[model samples]
Target: SQLSFINVQNRGNFRWPYDGLYQDEDGTLSGVVGGIVLSPDGLWSTSTTCTQTPNFLNAKTCPSSVGRWVRYAFNNANLAPNGEALFIYDTSNHYTIVLNLKKRLTHPDGYMMDLLTRQSYLFQFNGANSSVNLSYTGVVYDLVPGDYLIIRHNIDYIPDRVYTTSSSILAASSNTPLTAT
Candidate 1:
């Protein structure tokens, strides 16, 4: 069914996804803006470019505030590396996937790793693969996330491969495959 805006006097059952939005049942829920939602167990990334105030509601609980808002309001940048990349969660399925440039990496699918000397070059793909779509823009320095390019690497998929590059280079590669060393 197509959605059509209506002038109903009440929107009774429509509760927002966030806890503090649309209502003020909690004493401290009013007049607040901006919030960060780090999934049940998700990583928190920080960037030097972010500048904004986070909501008081989830201030202590949210792993990131301004960065989260920035990434959301404007998709995460994939074209260039930033001043900081803070990854705090560890899962078995999250991996770093990068665009294949010049056809040098060996996965036949452009599955190039930062290094080729490790036991596995693949990272765990997070649970959102089904909804992801990736695009190659010929560079990684400032890649914006939602062309649906999911870079999650699963260790289980590339079992015999090892990441030859350090985590730093891997992080950089995720932004632009050309500048990685």
Candidate 2:
């Protein structure tokens, strides 16, 4: 899908099939903001751009105020090599999936690993921002050969969500082809 949104309510996982996924706005759920990629065991990542805030609300357990809030720019600069990207839960303690930019053969779809359960989930969006529309397949699919672009909007509302859309000349490559998905 070109653009999609999946509501993550009462859940700690999120996934975007073929695009960059991000939080809807600068809005925070229970005082948490932005998203981050985690290791398979929900421990660490190679990315140095992500910021961690202690004592942040755990959207999974909001109102109770438990867990840390991780922040990262949903752009190429903060792009992860290959891992699940997570955003702060919404006001109702759910997550919503949004669009993002670029994808690679090695890194095709996005996956979410529950920190508490460590259960991996594969998800897709219905392009609607409603809670009932989203669903998980309970299976991870193989990567398809195509030029998929996951474009996360350069949202500046949240200080941590600020990202640049500009591309670096040295990093820019004309070899990558954009295949219609």
TM-scores for the candidates: 0.20, 0.18
Predicted model with the maximum TM-score = 1
**Model 1 over residues 34-67: C-alpha lDDT tens digits?**
3332211122223222222233222222312223
Candidate 2 lDDT, 10-81, residue by residue in tens: 323323232222231232422333333222122222213433322322212121122232222222223334
- All candidates' lDDT scores? 0.25, 0.29
lDDT of 1 at 169: 68
lDDT of 1: 0.25
